[model samples]
Target: MLWLDLEGAVNVRDVGGIPTDDGEKITRGRLLRSDNLQNLSPADVTYLVDHVRLSTVVDLRSPAEVAAEGPAPLTRLGHITHVNHSLLPEHGFDATAEALLVRRKREEERFPGDPSCAHYLGYVEERPDSIVAALRAVNRSPGAALVHCAAGKDRTGVVVAFALTVAGARREDVIRDYAATGERLHLILDRLRSSPTYASSVDSVPEDHHRPRAETMEAFLEQVDKRHGGVLGVLGSNGFTDDELDALRRRLRT
Candidate 1:
């Protein structure tokens, strides 16, 4: 993971040069992952748009988040294609507090030992269509594809992991990439706390609770394997065709 030092988003990084199981490397500048882009400075925008040549933004944020946050800097750029594929259910942010609690409880029950893993699984189970569409957007990006959610942790991690897996990246490398966000948890939390859309939720939890764990990702992948055969299986079952997977692999691999 190559970290991009941007003023607004701390958890931005290029997931390039990662080795695949077949001895190939993921091409640099092809795919990037980031937290919210709501506060990006002009220079940061220039760096991403001009220097990085970012072409597509796969925003995994819920509709409520996008509406709450309003237009981001990237959204104003005429050349960039922004695709919103919320991995969570549409009612995610609009639900009552009690309803949210009930959903979280059900997610925990999905994998009693690891709530994070279960939550990740919920993305696949609850919104597989979004998952497939997000991957398709990445594959079709004209240049670098930047994937992001609120904190660039859960939803972003799941989608990026699926893309990496489809690109033939090694399992350990995928888990490592997912856990890389933990290194910037403090910055991520700070960014979230500054946003009215996420501030209250950020304050309600202990910071450590937000840290991404390698074990969680490992278990998530294991469950994916067991339940759907693998990432490709999950995508296939969700209407993502083999030809699209091949195109994604070709787009990501060197």
Candidate 2:
């Protein structure tokens, strides 16, 4: 994972240069994973727009989160395409932010053990359509596509892992990218703590809850292979055709 040195977002990184199972590296500047873009500085905007040529912004945050945070700077600029593909259930869109987070935590904690892995799997099992759509957006992007959630750890991590897996990125490399978020957890949490929408949610949760463990993502990939036949199977089952899959591979692989 190549960390993007931006003044606004802390967990932003390039999901490129990952070695595939077939021995090819994912093309750089084609895909990016990031945290919220609600605080992007002027220089940050210029860098992403002018230098990176970011063409698509796939936001994994829920409708409530988007409403609370307001429009991101890129959205206002109107040059880039911003698509909200919320991984969480939209049934609770009207709920308070605290209530929504509480509901999410409860769902993740449903299993006494392995809450993190379970939560990761929930994203696939619960909202496969959104996952498919997000990737489709990436497939259609004319330039680099930026995927992001609130902290760029859980939801964003899940989607990026799925995309990389489908592109034949090494399993260990995918896990490494997911676990890399732990290295910047403090900065990510600090940024979230400053937001009214996320501050209360993070305040009640322990720091350990935010850490991205490799084992969690490892088990997630394992379960996907066991249950869905793999990333391609998940995508196909969720309405993504072979053409779409090929397009995605073309966009990511070198």
Candidate 3:
């Protein structure tokens, strides 16, 4: 994965050129991942739409977040298809202190060893439909598909990991890509702290806690393998078809 510098977003990157197990590489301009695009400047939009040929946006934020933040700049573009597939549960919309506490408790219960890993696992266990649908949107995109959430670390990380795994990318590379976010955790948190929709959640946590660790993703993928067989196993059990999986591999790899 390679980072893309943009004026409006800090964590935007192209998930291309990743090597697969069979010595193939993921094609550039086919997939991207990013933080929220609410503040995207006109130039950033032009670069993504014209230069990157971005065609689809798989937003993994709750309905309340989308509504709270209002329409993103890309939504104004007539040609781009925007799909919202929130990985959070229905009650995730409530951003209250109590709600956040309860959510964290639930995450700990899912995997007491690592709540972060369990949170990642919850994307598949609790919201498999959204996970499968998001993958389908990526596969069906005519050009590039950009998947994103608020900080582009958890929800975006999980989805991008699944995409790369399904496309046969090496396991270490997947974890590396997820951990890459740690390099920009400061910038990501700054952006989140500036937005009302996310400030409370971000401000309440320590800076170190916001960092994405390699072990978190490593454990998440290990559990996916242990419980669901693998990334493909989770998708297959969630109604993703074999033909669709093949198409996804073809779409991302060269």
Whole-model Cα lDDT of every candidate shown, in order: 0.92, 0.89, 0.92
**In candidate 1, where is summed lDDT lowest over 10 consecutive residues?**
87-96
lDDT of 1 by residue, 34-63 (tens): 999999999999999999999999999999
Which ten-residue region of model 3 has the weakest summed lDDT? 91-100
Clashing pairs in 2: none
State which candidate, 1 or 3, has the greater TM-score: 1
For 131-245, candidate 3 gives per-residue lDDT tens digits of 9999999999999999999999999999999999999999999999999988889999999999999998797768898889999999999999999999989999889999999
Question: Residue 249 error for model 2, in Å?
Answer: 0.7
TM-score of 3: 0.97
Badly placed stretches (over 4 Å) of model 3 are 95-100
lDDT by residue (50-131, candidate 2, tens digit) is 9999999999988989999998889987778989998887655467779777867876664447887777777888899999
Cα displacement (Å) at residue 238, model 2: 1.0
lDDT of 3 at 163: 94
Please give the RMSD to the true structure for each candidate, in Å.
0.9, 2.2, 1.2
